[model samples]
Target chain A: MADHQQKSDKTVHRHEALQKKLALKEERKHHNVSFIMMILLTLVAFYAISSDKIGDSFAVMFILVLAVVQVFFQLYIWMHLSHKGHEFPIWGMASGILIAAITVASLMGMIWTS
Target chain B: MSTHASHKKRTGLMDWLTTVDHKKIGILYLLSGGFFFLIGGLEAILMRIQLIKPENDFVSAEMFNQLLTMHGTTMIFLAAMPIIFAFMNAIVPLQIGARDVAFPYVNAVGFWLFFFGGVLLNMSWFLGGAPDAGWTAYAPLSTVSAGHGVDFYVLGLQIAGAGTLAGGINFLVTIINMRAPGMTFMRMPLFTWASFVTSGLILFAFPALTVGFFLLMFERVFGAHFFNADMGGNVLIWEHIFWIFGHPEVYILILPAFGIISEIVSTFSKKRLFGYSAMVFATVLIGFLGFMVWVHHMFTVGLGAVANSIFAVATMAIAIPTGVKIFNWIFTMWGGQIRFTAPMLFAVGFIPTFVMGGVTGVMLSVPAADYQYHDSYFVVAHFHYVIVGGLVLGLFAGLYYWYPRMFNRVLNDTLGKWNFWLFFIGFHLTFFPQHWLGLMGMPRRVFTYMSGQQLDTSNFVSTIGALLMGAGTIVLFINIIISASKKNIASADPWDGRTLEWAMPVPTPEYNFAQTPLVRGLDALYVEKTAGNGKMTPAEPVGEIHMPNGSILPFIMSVGMFISGFGFIYANWYAAGGGLGIVLITMFLRSVIDDHGYHIHKEEVEADIKGGRA
Candidate 1:
């Protein structure tokens, strides 16, 4: 699963390389699109934060949502986490998020003395 | 990118100090953990002796508090966790048919960090006082306590916890990426499954402790109050964070113990594990539920009814998965050819003892009921039954079961019997009466009780039991020495073992497998034994094997951590900064140097295979 070794048959190997080139092109397109969208998300976040019409809490939530989307783009495109051999890293991040959520929930719900 | 850099094999102390081999590191873990276990046991004995008679004053109340705190801290952090890691490091790679863990260098670094951290924690005894704020290090009390005791606790655990986190990630990666060709998720041996789940728990859990410790350290060292209620900080935050880590921490210890039991039970029963998939599911469920129930530990703190009820129910729900495991073990033995070896005896013993502990656990989970049991001997007995009766027994079972493979000498069976009976009977006698003592209003962590309170006889009996347990440990130490010198060489598959680990030759090679064994199914070795000749079919032909080079940098890095931790405890900024600088320099050197590891050539591997030596 880690590797797909190329065989020494010339025509077949050339076809395989052609397929890989198409896939790379597709991935590059995705990366470019995500980069543009990420910039747009950041601008939207800035707007939410600076706009006078936005309530303080609403702006915070709006920016937080944008940040999450931006993080997905950054991780999948910039960090190449969308590539193969990234399952365990994804599992780690998901579990960390789960536990962090639990910790924040408990701290907010139960710990305050006031 | 690979190169064959020939180097001389290290011998004696240098071999031990610099070696990145998992086997040697496992033994190092065992030795250090065993040393700390003895220290913790001694502390337990002293506390028991102090409480032997009503109003006994052999040790001062202050001393008793220190002993209690250190005993809990040392046993949990330095002793039990490291011992668990020892078995994991020693056995998991072999069981998975991998040559070594994914990150051998990090593994060495983890071990040394733990060693230095434990040493730093113990140094407090010679310098001033040990941490008297309990293992949990609850806030307010931990914050207000005088001296550098809790500082040691904070800094030492911070270093140790970092090591444990690294270890957890290493195992997670190793198991995920390094299994033999045919090993699949469901086909993995139960011990590996247990270790996988335990590592996940450790990964998700230990960071909470690191965060908690940082807060506590800041409050103590820098006077940045995160825990002191007097400074408008919430003390309850500390409790929440600690138990957030602490609760899963117990599971981290016991889950591997559960794994050990699973292996020993099936091997001794000479059967495939009953409900293997259910067992795996239960193990994972237990690890997941472990985090949800930390609030139960704080039930008596007057969290609202809703909060208490939610956590209470969550706590009780863990018993369902645990119960599934208990029944699976029994079913595994049912109608099978059961051999009552020392390890098997511990596995058999663990079931009922753990059940008793579970019953008490459920009882304590009732928030209303817990008010009475809070800070009482009942709580002590409850946890001891689970920890000592459950985890310790499983560890002993693991030690006994893997002893042949580890040391290449069978421990004297007669001595094993003596050790088991003494320890088993002694453990029960020691903790059983504490339940009644708690019910009779004998509060725990106290130096003594008044005479005629119905606690005297129980205390005495408990002390006697402690002595017997101590004696049993001594007998074990003697057995290890005698057995090694006797040189009673064991066969590779001693006890007709069923796992992939048993497929190896005795004194496992540094490269664990010459040719990675193809794992066909659950009990892969058993499948081969029954279907064909017992040898694993090699997944690949003999080939050059790349192996990691051993370096002393991990050792040096750990020493630097120790110095920095110590410096932080005393507010010595120069020492702290200089020590950290040393660590930074070592890491930089490691990165800049091109230490392309050497390889075991195909000829050498072929020779070993032909000679039946690998």
Candidate 2:
């Protein structure tokens, strides 16, 4: 009878542990934070464009930097790319970016020279 | 599903239409690709006949243009790509020890789309006329060309390109996610490695073609002005986009051929591939560099000295990795117990032929020399040498090597040798003279030439060579028929195979592996053989096998797309609407349908094993 009671207790403990993992409340919190940050970044870009306080080139550069940051957040936080076991996909994406950069750069060169 | 019911359902023509088995789909690809290959070959022969004599009037100039265009389009898109897909489907899953591709439904969709798209493209010949502005289909000529020829090119390629893209994505995900336990990237067969890189190329390169075709479609069908220089659009844009896709496409075709040769050479030589890690690196490097060299094709377009120099340099840089591969193959054969099988013969022959093609390729890569070589028979000879000699030879070798795996029979060896020698000699005979012809000032894409222009003898020899090739193909067909009729069942490990694929039964089961294999090292099967165990160690106990159910939705979806393609070409809005409606409805049904699929019990698997042995 004592052994049966201990086994039942262990089962309950394992169930609670699984519940804790499945809740994912921490992940949800991080997602909310990232989402808000994205919106704020967008608003800042809008303000920089609308206000004349900054120079046009500075504003454009600022927005571009912000855009790059947003993309990181999107990939890492939203898409869970920061999580483990995504190395191959990350490699594929990086290669794609490299090729795209080359293509765009070449096209720009062609147009500029022409 | 009851075993008897499932068995009954799997036996008929209807099953083929609805089946989602990778092997079955592979057969479909082979059959369709073979059919189109014949059509393309016929076109080639007719062109040869026209050029057999100077000032020949066998075919008009207009018809000749159509034939050349169709020959290029059909062979590249319809024949070569699908045949590559055939081997990929038949082998990759088994090589990786996966039950099925990552997306079985999407795989079915891909095949059907390709089929319907090919049918739609060919339908142009019967309806009005085929596309005649060259398979390249440069902007102004394609845009201003009268009739619906270019329309078919635009729509057909659009649909087929979608299928190719889907297949590419499917392979990427499958390789990434579905490798067996202990099967690291380094442990993969060279064929799978090459395929992985090819898939990556397809993913990146095909989109350029898609965008180019979309622009053409809009110009031709919707009266858009994307390519209209008069409307302030650039004509060179089309050339840029086409080659961006076109250059990598050649790699996409050849890389898998390289993979096939690697497998065949290693198997026949009774040794592992030499410089295995370097081979992998070179394959990836080739794929990466493929994108940087598209401008080599456009050197004559006056991209200016700077652009031409950069592009030329980049193009020549590709030869490094390709040379690495070539040397690796030769080293693979060095000091090994070489069996000189039909497949090995092809592999050995491929080396010199591809090298010759590559030498010419580098010669043409020089921008100044390209000015002399552009739009000449030299360019034609160079490509045919690579395509026919490299890709086609590799394909035939792969067929001989894997025929026993695909079908439970061995192809007749003597006949196989005849097929090889005939095709090899014939291939050289047909194209070698063309190189001289190009230097002799005979232009390409022309229907006739004046008498006594010094082109007759070479052209005559080329025609005879083409006829010999035709005879060689006939011998292959007869060999296939005889092998099938004789029922010469092959052993499971025919050729003392090295890979995971040969571990399965002759007629591979639906689940492929009865239990998932535990891959211990490179050439997993060979490792076991050396260890005195001739079979793989199963990673899991025999259990119920879960399989995706076959569905006809993919076929219906393709038919619907075919109808919509016609609707677009003919400007029939209602037909378009109806076709799209059918597609959308089927998609909705598929979404709503909860097909958890069926399972094969462990008892059934046991029974199959026992019966096969019996």
Candidate 3:
């Protein structure tokens, strides 16, 4: 009975190890995809800013959009914000961004322009 | 790190100076905060005496200005903020079933920084003069003010504000990460929930003040052009930034007060807080809205009609969440068995008093009306109604409610009641007539008024009332001293408290719980009493407890900051460099040192439990 139990334990360990390996591979795939996408977005932003075809105003807006997207990729893939137990960090970041945006917009509009 | 010699706790003054225990630090906050409260109260009484009769020269105009600035700064920053911190440090961890704050070292650092910073600010009285540019310290006036008074304000608040920010982050992390098993976010007591939101407000709000202070400091010390309009800097920017921080700061003060009232009212009424989830929702909503309504403070700044309307609406919208809270408190006591403990009286008093403040607040929120009310005695009446009537009363309630937990003695009930009535009635008498005085064209921050303006009677009444309030405060001090001296120990569950904090043994152990409590539901202790065994189930088996070692480093670091503040104020480079060097050296030492902390062994914990001291 002891021998049988040991064999079953070994099997469970092996199964878990295999599962971990597969999950690691999947995570690597996701990271690589996000990395490539971020690189592409940065290049596109550079093109928009440098290219003669894109207007200055439109390019500024486009690059801003790209920057925001890149930030999400960095947070999710590199910082692992997509992982479990990151709800608090996400809430914190979101609220912080909201407040910062409001403050900048109002201060600029009220003081700088005026 | 695990040396047997480190197992013994330090005692006496050395213990307090080196202590990192949350409870000890809390006591330190309370003691320092109480001291500052007295100083601020004295300043207020002096000002009242000056204003007692028309054309009275009890204090010079310059003296009154300094007194006014120091009074507002001290009461808000030194007294109320630290006292709120006192309760937060003492109660939040126990409520959430945690051994200590998440970063105990940082907690100590925060306290000492605030302490030294307050001392530095007060030291201005003897050194040169207290800041006379008003607590708001609007730009060019502060920038061009003679002497080092404003410099003290800039540096002292900057240092103190850093401490507040550290404390805020510590509480946030503690609440988010340190709850015992089954103590979910939803199950957290109202005070803990309120603290969590207050911490969030502090996190976002304090940085604005820090930036404002830095700009002001640079302009003052380094001759920077940040707030100098002639140097192409706009003075309005200072106002904007100050209010941005200042508005949420009021919430930061009052939210914890709201939480205290909620706890006291519910506990004394023998009921679970009515609309628990709604209360939590309202708290979060209020916090969010607090940031949005900074512009209301600036409505008279002429940001434009559109801006005023938008901010005005946002300001009024906050009333919705505040109303929700007020009704919830009333409903909490609707059908329950209400005990008129001192804490309960304060809580009951808070309900109507805070509502009056809120009513006046809504009245002031109208920008068109604010044009008439701006910088008037009406504004003073409105804020005093909220701050003194709302927050101070709530603080008194918390002191009575949590006295047993902090020290194993209940305050004297009869004396406590006298303290309440005197304070409560005096508060009304003082600020209630200020509204009429404002309407009758009495301005704030003034030394004296003309004799025949119909303001004399109100001013006289207000002065007498201020004296009564001062007397009430004295009564409370006597009550504290008298109660603490008595030998009769309070039971573990004094007042039949509903939350986990009340479940501890009479003299709380250095390690709060002998074993981690497995929280079952909202009002965890009460839930257990009603449905299961009348005790918290142990989440873990008996085990050794690891506690952080007391360190003097936080004290040293704060001393360094205090020195740096002086250096900046006086423009002494060597002092600044030396201070910075001291801080850096301490940081280096802390990084390299490996103090893994000592442990209370399992046997000792078991013995404590058996002795009824855990």
How closely does chain A match the true chain A in each prediction, as TM-score?
A: 0.84, 0.74, 0.82
Between prediction 1 and prediction 2, which has the larger lDDT?
2
Model 3 has a clash total of 0
> Model 2 over residues B182-279: C-alpha lDDT tens digits?
89999999999999999999999999999999898889989999888789888888998999999999999999999999998999999999999999
lDDT of 1 by residue, B308-388 (tens): 999989998998999999999999999999999888998899999999999999999999999999999999999999999
Residue-level lDDT for B164 in candidate 3: 94
Model 2 misplaced regions, further than 4 Å:
A1-32, A51-62, B1-8
TM-score (chain B) for model 1? 0.99
lDDT winner between 1 and 3, please give it: 3
lDDT of 1 at B452: 83
- In order, the Cα lDDT scores of the candidates are 0.91, 0.91, 0.93
In model 2, pairs of residues that clash are: none
- The Cα error of candidate 2 at residue B400, in Å, is 1.1
lDDT of 1 at B34: 95
- The lowest-lDDT stretch of 10 consecutive residues in candidate 3 chain B is B1-10
Which candidate do you rate higher for DockQ, 2 or 3? 3
Residue B422 accuracy (lDDT) in model 2: 94
